[model samples]
Target: MFSAAAALLAGAAAQPAGAEEETGSGHAVVRPVSGVSPLPADCGEPPIDGYVLNPNAEVLPTVATDPNRPWHLVTVYQQDRWNRYGSNGAVTAVSDDYGKTWRQSDNLPPFSRCNGGTAANGGDYEVTTDNWVTITPSGAAIAASLSLSRTGETTAILVSRSGDGGRTWDAPATLARDDNAQFFNDRPVVTADPYHPGVVYAVWDRVDATDAGWTQPVYLAKSTDDGRTWTTSKVYDFPDNSGVIGTQLVPLADGTLLIGMHHETDTTAATQVIRSTDGGATWSQPTLNVPAPFAVGVRIPDPDNSGDPIRNASLPLLAARPGTGVVSAVWQSQAADGTFHIDYAQSKDAGLTWSSPVRIDKTPVGSAAVPVVAASPNGTVAVTYYDFRNNTADPATLPTDVWAVTCKSNCTQPASWREQHIEGPFDARKVPLTSAGRLVGDYSGLVSVGRSAFTAVYGVATGDSANPVDIHSAIFTG
Candidate 1:
């Protein structure tokens, strides 16, 4: 049943005009971009700025295999200087073989280097870059939303595409054309519904960052014509947007749109949901707010509400119904052991309601990174995250790896989580993915942690290893 469901979900998860074929090994094979075929880039030993070329770094592995080219697998990410930093600018790369060979799309769609130095209105924005990547259903189309900012400006959003698998692109068109001074950025999740893959949804937090204070609201837009044309702005009801953390979107089985939002608030805060039965035009008012542990009385807040060194620290995930409409949410609870305890909540009824939170990560690992929710048709649950509950790994720190645990069906989580070391040849571990072994880290860059069939994705730190990040991506399936 699970295998059968997976087949159907494969169809449902199709991006609108998605990626096409090519070949390589390990999940992907690297090669020269079509136009630059004979000219292999010198990624170098330490890699150069805007060209460090981790060729190993991978982000948001939107994986697909070309039907005609049974030997090739395709993956995509924002190329940049090695270190994972900077959302202000981004580039795209692809791998043909499973996860072995790779290539960066140098021939971009006539884009102006607006942010890096082209800050016409450019200014310093988040060091993070792109997180979400989507390809058309037929794998013929590709779209990526990048974070941007102008001189003395807040962060902005940009979208670019290519007809030939990340090859040459149309000069990236400014998706956030109305950037009057809003710092709307982070977590750009883009995907096309399977039924009508042509219809694309670009959802992100639209923030108003004026000196007075920052008011961030989650906004979503739909492109019926594959982004060539987009629907007018509509603010999806996610009051949690006050500082709405990552809002994960999943196209449900019954044509209903399900959204799982994680929150920063404590008592009154709980992951909430809103749905679009009629596409995205209308969304239900905020669902019953499911307060965090503090409010439930099961968990107590820090007496002082002390600030965690990591603000925007919490990461939540939604188990999207790849081909069906089953939605489940998972996250590390505030009452967590810091080492790596993860909890899960499900909304079988399509976001209308949720089950009580359950501790899904039972392994009691030393520490936990972020959690990812990848749903199979029969609801086979694949939850992956990092184990740092006890201590984190660093090239200078220690050996850290990406970990994952699986369940037989939806909601049937394991009693204890198991660890899988996913430190690519590079060994940078972060942003654990639910889809496979994917991780999101540094440049907002994403890649696979270690070398395993299960693909891991994360960013590489370049400058200062803390600032001006770029994005990278790759895939492996163990």
Candidate 2:
């Protein structure tokens, strides 16, 4: 029954305009522009002047562009350098000139026990992180994030909407709130319903402090009146409290939603999902793939610090074609020689079945991590990721680059893709580390604009006197 539902939804989504054949011959070209960060010099945070915003880190940028106005783009992200449980707030950036430049805004929504902020807008609760933004066909923008109160005793899922192209926003409405004294809420994502304008969806996993220990339950919510109000449902209950990360929600043209997430246990990691056909009202049983050998480790150049690795591991990334049910997924895996590389697979029949996994990145010398994939209106599939391939310096200092590949046509064919450089050659060490000790946040973003274009935003260490990690945007065309 689930397979039938997936196939039906896949068929409902419109396929790309042309045949599934190669179109261009050259490489996937990305033009760089002078984009701006969402936060100002002081990030609107009064007390801290040049001290924080000047050399601070803005990471995990998620973008949403207007369908009619291709040049109008809206993005949201977390503020402050990596502070683990304590983050400044959420900030927004708007671009009207095809991403040539950006304007900052304090449009983040608020949550329980806290009145929304303005003088220094951003952040939900007193400490917030894991922000996501998306746009409706009417060009309205919606933002969501996980936030905690000043005392960190409560956590809530907060959302806000921007009708004026992100220049201004409405007060946030809360979807879920809990004491959070023993549980934690993290990594929540939002998606706009393409078929039904003004309707949007949000999903995240909830950890509960059960008497046995802990258990993870997935939750879903929907807002039909453009985020003014919301209704939430408990989607599924995992057998154990395994950690779920890198969750991607894909809304089909037929009103069905597909969720792709990486579920991790103590010994192994796997890609899993729970589908909702009636706007997240109910969900099918969780479908999981075979477990892959996985371990978290960071490579350091200093021999003395080599054994002490940071929290790092491969998490699944997913993308779905605009009109078609064709979906592509990628993650990182280590080969026999101990080299980490990016792997790819696709599902022609929605999430029912996927092709055999194929290694996609060029010969891996250093390592490739945090892969993000997106599909163009022309049926072109693009994958963006960070790698140390160009790092000639000591591995401890970690110099990396942002690279992308285009599958002109037959994306399922491993050899049908061409590689192109987007941005980078910056020192990763300069970027602040999360409580997890990982740089560049857990994931970045890559979004397709129109028939022939796409955009990606990532964090890069400027290595200037301040040594801050700033946000950079690149527009790519074949």
Say which candidate scores most in TM-score: 2
For candidate 1, the clash count comes to: 111
lDDT of 2: 0.65
Q: How displaced is residue 103 in candidate 2, in Å?
A: 1.6
Off by over 4 Å in 2: 1-55, 106-124, 149-152, 241-243, 286-288, 295-314, 393-396, 465-467
TM-score of 1: 0.67
Task: Compute each candidate's TM-score over C-alphas.
Answer: 0.67, 0.83
lDDT tens readout by residue for model 1, 1-478: 3332233224442222112222123333222222211112432234234322233233333333332322233444444323333322344445443334455554532222422323442222332354455566555444545444322144545555565545545544455644465555555666666567577777776655565555556677677776556654646533332456466566776888866665443235566666778887677765524555432112111112222111123456565545555566776665444333567776767778776777766444443446665544344455665443333333232233355555544463445334343432232232222112223331122222222223334433232332222233333332
What C-alpha root-mean-square deviation, in Å, does candidate 1 show against the real structure? 9.4
Count of backbone clashes for each model?
Answer: 111, 5
- Computed on alpha carbons, the lDDT of every model, listed in order, comes to 0.45, 0.65
